[model samples]
Target chain A: MSTPDDTQFEAAFADLAHAAELMVDPVDSAVIHGRVRRRRTTRGALAAGLAALLVAAPAVWWLQESNGDENDPPPAEETTATATPDPTTADESAAEPEGGPDGQASEDVEDPVLPAFGDLVGAELELPEFQPDGGSLNDACPSGPATLADGTPEWEDGQWYMHEGPVWVLKVVHTKLEEGGPTRAVALIGCMPVETMVRQAVVVAGDGAGGWEVTEEVALGDTSDFPLFDIAPAATAGVLLMVTDTETTGMYEPVPVDYRIMRYRTGSDLEDVTGEAYLLGVTDIEASVEVTEGEDGTWRIELTLTNAGDHEAVGFQMTACGSDSFVLEEFDLPPCTADSEGVAVYEGLAAGESVVEEWTFTPPPSQEWSGDEDSGMYLLGDVRPTTYSAEVFVYDPDLSNNGFRVDVTPEDVA
Target chain B: MTPTRGTRHPPAAEQPLLLRPTLEFDDFYAANVRTITGQIFAYTGDRAEAEDLVAEAFCRALARWHKVQDYENPTAWVRRVAWNLATSHLRRRTVAQRFLKRQQEVHEPPPDGDRVDLMRALAGIGERHRKAVILRYMAGLTVAEIAHQEGVPEATVRSWLARGKAALAGRLAVHDEMEER
Candidate 1:
């Protein structure tokens, strides 16, 4: 036989079901086909672009080194070709710190003839307000005919077309969870010209300690694909590092070479308070506790228990351990079952799930407990091996202050 | 017109090639194009983006038409494609839209008095609960069908329905109280 509460609950659910029924319809079938087709095209394009990069990288490097002589010939170039050993020829030169056969430099390489603008071109566009809030990029321009001073550029439209490729920015947001645990961070990266094909790599560091590092690269074909990527759990504390390469091109060389890197991080410390609760499992049983008033005219703890896995718990039993100093204001539980311990449990709690319970207490007359002394600390014990895991709270009857304690003993299960 | 040895006499005049319908290609395009487009548009709430998504879906479908046509519910097949496409689009365009416009608006307030309250409760519910409510009430799907579609145990679906209903009632009560204030 069901109680009045069960009946009321069923009625409420029926009403909700009726409401949901009013909002149904069949979606247009044609539109579905079109969307699928478009997605396929974009993915195909991106794949092709990556494939091209893989194929062309080595070839481009080879071409660059071979062409370097047109600009600067080696000191031994005047020597007879046959007399010079092959090992000491282009191969040895390629291994030099000043860039070898491939024209890629080993750290100390310096260009003898620097361009007028110091190899840096392009002006800094005003960054978007929503750009990543962490990590700053280290800027280097090897072919600067254009120069930027004080974050602005001198020429607007020569080699740099107005808004041609992605303008990149990076920032980190961090979130801390639990004390002494590594904080989770979300790296934010913003790229502009939203239409240019681009790829980016981001690294996150936690409190200068080692943490998980990931790199995500996205090649977008159009502006519609901006806000290209996101990292979750926006960090509360961490350093975010980002490197971005955009494709740029010149008349004789490949247009759309990879360009620019910007990085910055939120300097604030992140504190996160997120946790998980598990139900563990349930059993059919009953339990109880007691409550009494304290000397400070507030309700004092009689007994408390917490449900810690291993068994299912159904109800609780509370007995007055001291003088009746507290009055029961109300009990809370949906689909509630009766219990003697001033504790109740709802049905259908599965294993590995948890819910928070809150109780308010009022202090009795003549008992004034200091509120400052007892905040956030609760007296709760474990009631295990039964249907419910029992955790109890006790407070002053006047809502002034109270202590909480838990009692979980193997012998207490009944 | 001369008749061939093993064939019947052809038409006196030959028809222009352009005028001749390309049955295979046209049928393929018609059956696949619009359905995917519509599904994507519904999911994204943007006409231009929907167009792009649809185009991509069709391109992929065309590449694998032989395999796709063999599926039981081709329309459903296309819808899944569109759904995936729309999700990826949303992922890339996270900050572009101020808010995700829902695929469909709530046409009428729920049968219960507190429409807004019910919606808030619905929002708080998990994806399964919301889906259950949508399927059972709005889509008129049977519990068994919902189980099949969601790949969940029937009991799980029933539980979601029950929980969703109960939550809605509590929310409505709260709403009523607020209105009284």
Candidate 2:
């Protein structure tokens, strides 16, 4: 029988597996959720700032043009009309020349005005009843405004309020997803206290009579962090690319982690089509440890860090620590003190490759270290034990399984 | 590793937004975090490190929950991420030491003597063999599942298991001898 007697291995592994079950502390998922939200909020704020810059640039240019020409007509008397041209008027303007019917600048052929933020956020429209899950809104906590007058949303007595006046509209896009389709309004609505609030992506379609009604809504969970300032039409028809801040932001330019694909049809609701095309660049690297005794009665520690992935892995740093003061509480790898050092890899590790690092160290003259030596303890001086660890820096996409550790005791020495 | 294809995920537009399930993330995290964390703990041998790695993995999963939920096995994906995190954490000293440095005082007790011995023995084996053994015995994954997870053939997994068991048995035997001495 090629199978070695596994009775003892089974028992030991079983013990380890059982012990692992006990190691888990009750995690407060809310803390993690909060962290995710905070990161998202930070990214969103950054995006919004950039968007403000873009918007301000055009305004700055217009101001310069007006300042340069004293004869330029005064800014058209502030109008109640929004940036969204009335469909009927837009058709009329398109049918006519650039100038008026009377050969003067016509009111119908005016430049598009920027919509007031107040108008976009304060428009009278019906929002879909939002439930956290598929449950009814009635089951959700009571929602109210921060106060009756201010109407700022607040949480009171475990109930959340959305004050009557304005909901935070993160983005408002007037482009239609489908070609030759009605230009519908898409609003990304965020709740107050953006970091903790779960929000919705709402699609509003204009009623034949001119009012807008929420046609569809998607409840983006607390963890979803969409970029606030950017929404672009995808090259493909009926598709909208909604940027998210899930990936690392570049130093100079904001790099979106990925886009959420929203596809819409003339008669259908907006749908999230972000499917299996969302692929992550992942590589697996396995680390193994070995210990051998030298003829000089010193222990030779050998660590084999292998690139187990099929492709070359690049841009990783390594750090190693060796110490006799190996108390569980004091176990650490930084401050490289006299006992540790960090290594960096300049080149990439090819597939199926291995990097071997070895360290030879002598134990103290006396070996009276006592304990369960088999329990990952190694003797250094009188009773102090030695522990060692080596690790590679985490890479993008997948940040796990990149390091190795070893603990040595005097018994391993010759 | 490519997970086996299962039921095709229905398009989000197919169902009305209100009717579509929105509690998937909450339920998925609650259902799998402990198990995935435990598996990573067994792999990393350090409880605090395992917890941190698993938490990071789950956070990444949450960042892409909308897309991840449509996967064939979301839990398996989370577990793979956590396991890879643990593996990567184990190989690099600075990052791991940095992570360990920030750890609060560990409230959980250390593993018993037997568990420590097992971890030590695991450290001495071939990486693939060790992973196969853990995935099989500790994770309760069948040989075929280990094969799929490892992107190896089933027979290769069986071979690793046998060799892993033999190597582990030998290491434990040595430990037993040392105890007797």
Candidate 3:
């Protein structure tokens, strides 16, 4: 009789690997070979053309230099979309308060009440003991740009390799597991002004070695509005609160720079919320909705909005994104008078006050959307996605809000 | 993450210089495609995804074949790309899962086949240890080669192997016992 031992572990793994080998078809290089060949030919031609262009570029530049008009329209640069005029984009008379690299709230009001940073975060949220000393590209962060203990080049190199362009490690908050065996830290990151206005929430996991490993990074928003950003940890075990006074731009129409705060949970779920919740320094706007089937065979979607802040709610706009099985389409909103921007505006709600609104989704709505029948890319394994989402963009100077959605489910009336 | 482990990745500008595929690359692909696919398949229990990721990694290598062939082990370059693809694929899946859940958390087909016994056993160990085992057993890389590829110490590779095998042996025995009963 024979017994399995250390060698048997390799043998056992080898057997299962052999079994797994059969599960996948041998990767065919023919398609890849042809694709590479075509790309190479295209590249060679492009290089030759670029060489010719490069040779003639100096003459073109010389001619343009001599013929330069002092006031030729600058390149079609993207003008900031913030409703409140930014000092960077405004004339001297329209100058706003100084904005930090992290995009803190810029005060323009004669006596705008600005809350202190310490008051922004929750009582339970604790700042890290070893905070990064500096907030510039050249500054060394004592607790960040996590290096792996394994001594990999990325670990050994002091560069914050995960970020592009000049970046600042604004905040690094961690929760250590028993005697600091391993620590999980969330670093608030901001790129130089040249980069996009995207602030990042980077989660660094401490490897057993002295160094830290960057496990996750999520881009929260643009800097122009999040001028005053606050973070709340321990609010959710796997969730991190990214409270910033930002706007949901890319809406084409310009809305005021209302604070659009969101919750960033650490787990793998894409982002847990859309523009559905807000918790700013002094402004906390909570929204709840009820979905029910009506006697007329239509779906009733009722929305209740509440102000949990010290200030009164001045303006709030509601926009809905509807999708047929596989895509989000412009919502077929209920019959209601629209503002000049064509959005449904709810104005005037006092602090600690709640207001209710309702909308109805009629019957005869198609739940299934079709796609390529042959490949079945549309199928979420025998089912198709048929849901709708509604997001509210708040228009308060100090606060912002988000919205939620409803879907046809067995438990809920479809 | 894995791609940056080796000597700096051949720069993006170098791809155009390799205007044509050499017979050397064809020979290299012929020798290694099967083994790399098997390794990735074991790494990810999904057959279709393994094939797709492995193919994508090769496609990248083929584009940079001129410089890639010059690397100490071009196969390792493909492996790194495959591994990165796996991480990115998982991240994208997580996003899609959330979207689908919000859309309608209804019927989703269970994965097609039973995952390999080795994957279940490997799950009990840490990620780095599991990768070491797969690199050793499935990719047939030597301990020194894995150490170089991962940019870890040779002793670290050996330790990972010892711990991984020890953990795997017990998991496999328990799995076998349960299957028998």
Candidate 4:
């Protein structure tokens, strides 16, 4: 057998990468933004000067509020209430009339009981038209090929082993299209073996006479990759089926990425209403420079750095390039220098933070001075105007605002 | 180096909150979240966990945007933070216990067999090798970029990539044989 080349290896890795990309669920930026805001609020509260006083005041109220709010029952979608509560009566078959005004009681009166969602669906489950001809659900999931292509009977014991796990009925949700309308019962029912699990949704509607019938059976075909298992009532109407993809790499952590938001109305098929998820977070540092002429025949160079984005700019090494030229012109300020040790000279800038530095330099006074000399100061033979530009270099993510330059001309000098 | 003397202005929070800028952070977050999350997901094999880790890293970045924004590559910093968080979280969780619990509960749809095999192989490899492969292929980072971010020599990154590929191939080949049989 020939060995795979580098190109093949690269292609295979790239393919895996692409598949992983496709497998990821959309990220809700708003959710992340909320988390950040909450963290910041907590942090700010901690940093407040009156933190102890504030905490003392809120602690009492929070404890009382927490008792009620924290213990509140979970939302309706997670509840086991399979059928909608009727406003007027219980079951017509079992419910008894009220006692007479004479305070006499009826002995035969008994409240009605609702049937379990699983029992109702399981007793009426029939393979939808979309499913291939197979054994009844009571037989459990169909066990495929008893052997392998190599006639190995042990193949049945391999990864594809299909156990005869019982038919499983998942969550049942009760919702209605409009107020006072008949409540709809939506649930996910399926047969789970070891590997291949079949999923189907049975939607039943109340006839308002305590009678219920399966109005629509949705055939959710082979969900071996991304399973649409959980069912909940949609915010507006119908039912919402959530797809959860499990990550079985090294650990068995189940990652729930509300991957798809599918809506199934009474008569309509499953519709994809997935909203777009995008990224939201960036760094921006604004830089500006000012050059002004002083009455003392000197040029002033000012550089200002500001953190204009929501994030704080940290450990940025600010370099005022072209400062060495100013050093040759008898500048009152020392040359802006960065050490070889890579220290962050400017430190950091928080959101809406700014810093300013200024330097003043005097040009050559006479034309009799030598152009080249042993001294560090430059000697000019003429008063011809010279332009010195200063620029800032920062590690800002947004390069457009990272650097700022300002030109200072000696022509303005007297 | 000591910070140069400069006139410091009040923080933006002191001014009207509306005057603070946010568009840049939003744009940056929107641009890199998907790719970064995907890369982390490839490494961890859990998309939801990866997203949470990435979001956390970005949150830290925002908190210190003044400092992080000045880094040579802010995205790289975010990725490293996320990878570190993933490692720590994985270590904190009891994998064996979770596996047992998952087995008893209603089994979720396992990822594609090949994908599962690939992830299993990745898990068997060295941590550095797995990170290198994921960042290189999934994040589409160049060898030099990976080396710089990983704080290693480019040659070392190349070696890790080669060994990672060989390990994956060997494991996948065994899987294929078993499947074929």
For this target, which candidate reaches the highest TM-score against the unseen true structure?
Answer: 3
Q: Whole-model Cα lDDT per candidate?
A: 0.32, 0.46, 0.43, 0.45
Worst 10 residues of 3 chain B by lDDT: B102-111
Ranking by DockQ: 3, 2, 4, 1
Tens-digit per-residue lDDT, A362-408, candidate 1: 54332232342232222332222211011100000111111234322
Question: Per-residue CA lDDT of candidate 4, range A86-204, in tens?
Answer: 23223421232232222111111100111224223223333343245653642444323111011101110111112334444433444443322334455455555445455566665
Off by over 4 Å in 4: A1-4, A44-414, B1-21, B94-116
Off by over 4 Å in 2: A1-15, A44-414, B2-5, B8-22, B94-109
Across residues B1-181, which tens digit of lDDT does each residue of candidate 4 receive?
A: 0112334435766645643335445667887777777777777666766766677677656655555554556677777667756654443222222221222322223257566787777866655678887777667689998776654569979877876776677777777888899
lDDT of 2 by residue, A1-414 (tens): 133445655666667776777767635565445444443543443433332332222222222111221112222221112233335344333443232111122222211121212223334555543344444431241223211011211111111223223344434444334443333345555443323333455566544332345675533433345442223222222324333445222111222134454544555675665451111112344556676766776666676667675444542335444343333221233322353233323234556887776656555433533434434344221000001111111122222444455565444432
Q: List DockQ, one per candidate, in order.
A: 0.05, 0.14, 0.15, 0.07
Docking class of 1: incorrect
Rank candidates by lDDT, best first: 2, 4, 3, 1
lDDT of 3 by residue, B66-92 (tens): 567666667777776676556435423
Just chain B of model 1: what TM-score? 0.46
Per model, kept true contacts as a fraction are 0.03, 0.38, 0.33, 0.15
Task: Tell me how far the alpha carbon of residue B39 in candidate 1 is from the true structure, in angstroms, after superposition.
Answer: 12
The lDDT leader among the candidates is 2
Interface RMSD of each: 21.6, 18.7, 16.4, 22.3
Per residue, candidate 3 scores C-alpha lDDT tens digits across A1-414 of 123464665666667666665555654456566544443443443333332232222212211111112111211121121223424334432322233221111112111111111111111112221223444522432223322222110111111113333343434443221121122345554443333324455565423221234465544444554432433332222223443445222222233344434545444453433243332222345566777776876666666777766544433444443333323122333221221112233434567887776666643333332232222211010000000000011233322234455555422323
